[model samples]
Target: MDSTEVAKQENIQRMTSNENTAIVIDNENDAKFLMKATEMQLEKISLGKLAQQKGNSAEVKAFGKMMEDEHNASLTEIRTLAQSKSISIPTTVSEDSKDHYDDLNEETDNDFGKSYSKMMVDQHEDAIDLYEDAIEDTEDPKIKAWATKKLATLRTHLERAKQFKDKNDNLNS
Candidate 1:
């Protein structure tokens, strides 16, 4: 081939390689997001159930019920999406979240409601941040849409958690 033709062929090959690399990177990101999201959901469900059983306050128990139900629904949706994408989600919660669960399990009844409420506030805030980051980082349309859909619920959970925390604090004061 002539020098100009060789240069053209090399450029085409480079572009093709770059395109393949981009696809791989995008798939990796999608899998990571799915795994993280599933872990968070499982943790929320675990904590929420604990609160429902151990909470002293009616409001806290109600909030826990809400969290359990809603998080379960979100989990189902994400699992379906992950299956369609051929991604494997972890069946267990993350270690960090497991630590939180263990700590909450050790709380006394007098402290359980307040402690659980505060944890919910923190967890929901973290979840909102995670979803927001995923929405920004993901190139997949399905993942972006799932994150966007879940953001509204996460925000609502955060708001409710904060309200419960404030109310519990006021009661203690």
Candidate 2:
């Protein structure tokens, strides 16, 4: 590698081992909250799966698939990040997700599509809120920065979901 690449890697290593290592969540409760946040992230991906199965439009289906792909990858990375600090994510799907799945699962394909669209909107909204709060609350510099970036992406997803919902509503009307 060139000197520039070498320097960049060194800088990253420094940051990871330095200021970025300061974790705010120290207590058992904090770990619980962090795990909860991580689970919410996973839930978004889970809901995305339902959306992918139920969506009618190519665009909605594609977006849902994209969310599933991206968040699952993100979940893997986030899991690693958390585990590096000894943070253990919940082993099961969240209770809220269980109820949500129940509520959405029984609908017919057409109704499922609509329900899925709404769920996407709600999930994106919640994701945005969680990340934004994390950006403020997390003492881990690396995690805080990650949350900030993800919050922006989640907001974009929210807008896209809203647009898709509107277009779908228009077509149905």
lDDT, candidate 2, at 54? 72
Put down candidate 2 lDDT per residue, 55-116, tens digits, no spaces. 66677678778888877877776777666655555544667777887787776655666777
Candidate 1 local Cα displacement, residue 31, angstroms: 1.3
Residue-level lDDT of model 1, residues 59-161, one tens digit each, is 8789889989999999999889988976667666767777899999888665887788888888888888889999999989999998999999899889989
**Would you estimate the TM-scores of all the predictions?**
0.84, 0.75
Candidate 1 lDDT score at position 128: 89
Q: Mark the 10 consecutive residues where model 2 has the least summed lDDT.
A: 20-29
Residue 154, model 2, lDDT: 77
Global local distance difference test of model 2: 0.66
- How many backbone collisions does model 1 have? 0
